[model samples]
Target: MDLRSHSKPIEEFNFLDPAVLDNPFEYYRAAQEQAPVYLMPETGMYLVSRYEDLRQVLLDTETFSNNLDGYGMLQGENWKVHQGILQERGWPDLPTLNFTDPPVHTRYRRIADSIFNAKRIAAISDRIEELCNLIIDRFIDRGECEFVSEFSFPFVGTIISEQLGLDSEKMSTFKKWGEAIMAPTSRVMTVEELRENAETIVEMQHFIAGKLEERRKEPRNDLISALVSSRGSDGEELDMMELQSFMRQFLSGTYESVVTMISHGMLILLREPGVMEQVATDLSRVPDFVEEALRFDTAVPGLARLVTRDTELAGVHLPAGSIVMTRYAAANRDPAKFDRPDKFDIDRKDKAHLSFGTGPHLCVGRLLARRELVIAFRTLLTRLKDIELARPLPEIAHVPHALLRPMKELPIRFAKADAA
Candidate 1:
């Protein structure tokens, strides 16, 4: 694959060139080996695709930062637009925990860490299994079903909403409002359409505020009340802005990415009948299945960072202010990291993939996400005896701008459930 061809000049590199966007790997692989720090002339940012380099950048917050501009620019995402969409408009702004750097990151992490600790993880397994059973029951009899709409879409959607204490009536609106905020700049609607969409965001913020008020008057044992009642180790309550920030954090990563895992995971397994059969015969193989899916098609393809000071990594001298893209899509598939990286294996033994990231910014909600996938997969396959895709694998549709690679829909037909 002669990676050196891409090392010609930074000016020659076009990060968003149409072909590579459709097929990023062919270019990304070249970038990783030939020019691990090549600059993208199109977006005016540096690209990093190797596993080792990305791991370092993710860990060294001091060297690599995540300020908006530093995080690599999404097309049409300007500062004024950023401020308008994320801040004043109140579009699920959770204080930028994932995008913010240390000291602050450490401080904020401790607040949620206590709740997401080891014991808490072990405690939820049974309940997750139970929820898995209930969700699978709907599709069990039908055998054939749209996997996304039936399970993945609603699984993450319902799990987090339930965890956060959102009521049944408002779930649909909550999801719609969430989608509007998280849509990539390239995918967002036209200017007039955007203004119309912004109103939905405003209403969502109001809904959250209203729910907070209600929770205060009548408390419940859920994430919302815990957040409302939470105090820093110092016994200080989170300020109004902090509460808003926390909720935004929950929505941005937790809901979208986890749901992405299920949807994308199902798509891959369905495409490979052998893999599906392997899992169908033994539900216990789900953990490996989920891990392989993440490695094969990581949900968030890249994590961008800013170079704080002039530094050289892997023979590339990066300039300060270089917007570095840690391309997970490339890194996970790097031949150096995994064997036959393209072929989806149900029993991949490597733990080198960075789908949920590595080091400081490693996904905090990882436990919850893994549980959801395991439960969902085991439940559906076990209960629904024979399920198959409705159309050919290549005919499936997907929303390209989706940072989370989820199937647009998954139509299937299976045997009917037996009468009890």
Candidate 2:
């Protein structure tokens, strides 16, 4: 049960360490057993590792706020400098959906929920499968390809871009913009890096703003148009700042997490014996496999929540203004909540993993994400045969970031199903 028994003291464990970032499961296991709510000596942030504790924090948003303004890396002089850059070149930052607390958050969430409704997602099912097939067709003949770049990034980028009424051919540009927008939260950046990222973000803001104007003038059946036309409970439409914020969140949230999820799911199939074949033979099993992949190696390891009021979690006192990171990666593997928590069992009955989070702030685009994943794997398995890694597992590295777990590349070999 003791995963990292030989590791250093819990107090000395640095969550930001490269080695820890690469493989934090053992540390997570140790944290759950030793200190469910361990305070990181490096950042003074509390790491909430237990499943029940994270669930409690997520449910009680009043005590633990989602607002990151003047918190974590966004605090002090750095934040001011970053905000200055945005103000000078683009729309000033605003807390819209993911960054706002209830009452205010409710308005944005309602609009978002309406846009990403079940009907819209169901309607896109065929399009998702079509995109998957088209992407797979490009490399299927080669018998070897880099899955991350060749499949995952383009597939996700094109979908989100097209949904925003953008040119799918500019998916690479969109991908760059999305990464720039997410840089600050993903990891600590130098002043120079922050400014560079800010400039790119401003570019994106202006681009999306132009699109919003087009939608306002002549609305279309696209997400941007939905954001422009839809009214909140107050019957007020979202302003420019609010529209830009939603686009920013959507671009960053959708592209990276879903892309990583798809990549990780494929890696699992390649590693696990007989699992790929089983799912490939019966396409219905792909959904279960997708859920298990999410639980086993979630794209987003954790997210920060600012403590609004002094509170206690897992019996540990968390003072007001403290940052509590809901360790979704750790909680998903908690043995107390999941049997054989570390094992990648697709048939596992418990599906309560907090990968997309829980409560009101749950990811609005989860339905689209799940649909994309299912269609993606189903298409890949159907089109390719004998899928296996082209390089050793140790050679594949993950891009180091504080929030997301994304693999750099996944080189693999496969045979065209028809040719086979």
Candidate 3:
């Protein structure tokens, strides 16, 4: 399975390169233009960035496959998460959907569905709004704040913990751990970080397991209690390992993804004050603004998939096994699909953005993610009377990872949008 003998060059796959990683629009655009489907000597895989082309790969999971290697998350670099879980065989397991294809993927989807169902989300809508207001209130007087650290990170951090029936304190710990893992080029976590990650993942598994046990003895109205004691359609609970695996996936995936939403969303609003004013005045329009933000600065730069069978995508033909990298960031901003694609337009009503992805594997947490975003922007708009970039946009730094596109820091100040 080693493609090293016939591998592509990754001069571009210097996905870890600080300059390229921090701002990758031009590279992604170039790759998409060269070929919607082409093997890079650099990334060592096929990249699908055109909106039409990427949709085909994600929607048609059968031809594409979802096995560990096929999906980007479980590639060679992620061996520890998948294999380690099996060895532990219990509470301390890595719950990653990054490894499974369909049938198995379907099972995990059902488990996720049971808890993140739309109705359940609706039930918590008010509470989420309340939490958003509370957080916004804290920063409204200051008028400006670091949206990621001051707002998005802790808001979702607390809310996710409450949903899982875990402790807020533990959720804080997971936030740091999640940031480390998500930062592909994290300076703080050197190679030694991997060893620390092993320890963190193990501790995370145990923490979830303990919570699962607690929920079991005294079932609550939360997602964990439902998973620990609830049944599938057949009325049987997920085995211990399955339970832990689910939590692992849930926590890891959402942490950075939500962080991306906040960071990208702030960057756009700060740059385009008219959009922010409209969104602030009419909070109902936030979803559209958020959608634009998702497309304008897509958090996930791209996703990689290894082809399991020889096939034709776009017009390109390939062998049975190939690595496909789909670039959502490029496609979202593609002029072919979006009018003024390069510009941020909240009034753009077409919600066809590829930010949440297309096809069966559509992001499971999208609804919740949007809810948090809506509440967040509404609060930011009303709380801060005026907000602007704390630093020059060009000088500001970006997160050092290809996995998600978010900034590390943003200094903003504003007066409460509301006089009260």
Q: Provide the RMSD of all predictions against the true structure, rounded to 1 decimal.
A: 3.7, 1.9, 5.5
Full ranking by lDDT: 2, 3, 1
lDDT at 357, model 1: 87
TM-score of 2: 0.96
Tell me how many clashing residue pairs each candidate has: 6, 0, 21
List ranges where model 2 is wrong by over 4 Å: 1-8, 70-75, 393-396
Give each model's whole-structure lDDT: 0.70, 0.86, 0.70
**Model 3 vs truth, CA RMSD:** 5.5
- Model 3 has a clash total of 21
The residue ranges of model 1 lying beyond 4 angstroms of the native Cα positions read 1-23, 69-96, 121-127, 184-194, 393-396, 416-420
lDDT tens digits by residue: candidate 3, 263-298: 778878878888877887887888788778887888
Query: For residues 303-420, what per-residue lDDT tens digits would candidate 1 score against the true structure?
Result: 6788889998888788888878778887888777787776787767786689888877888888878877887777766666556777764443555552444456777776643333
In candidate 3, stretches whose alpha carbon ends up further than 4 angstroms from where it belongs are 1-16, 69-96, 180-192, 393-396
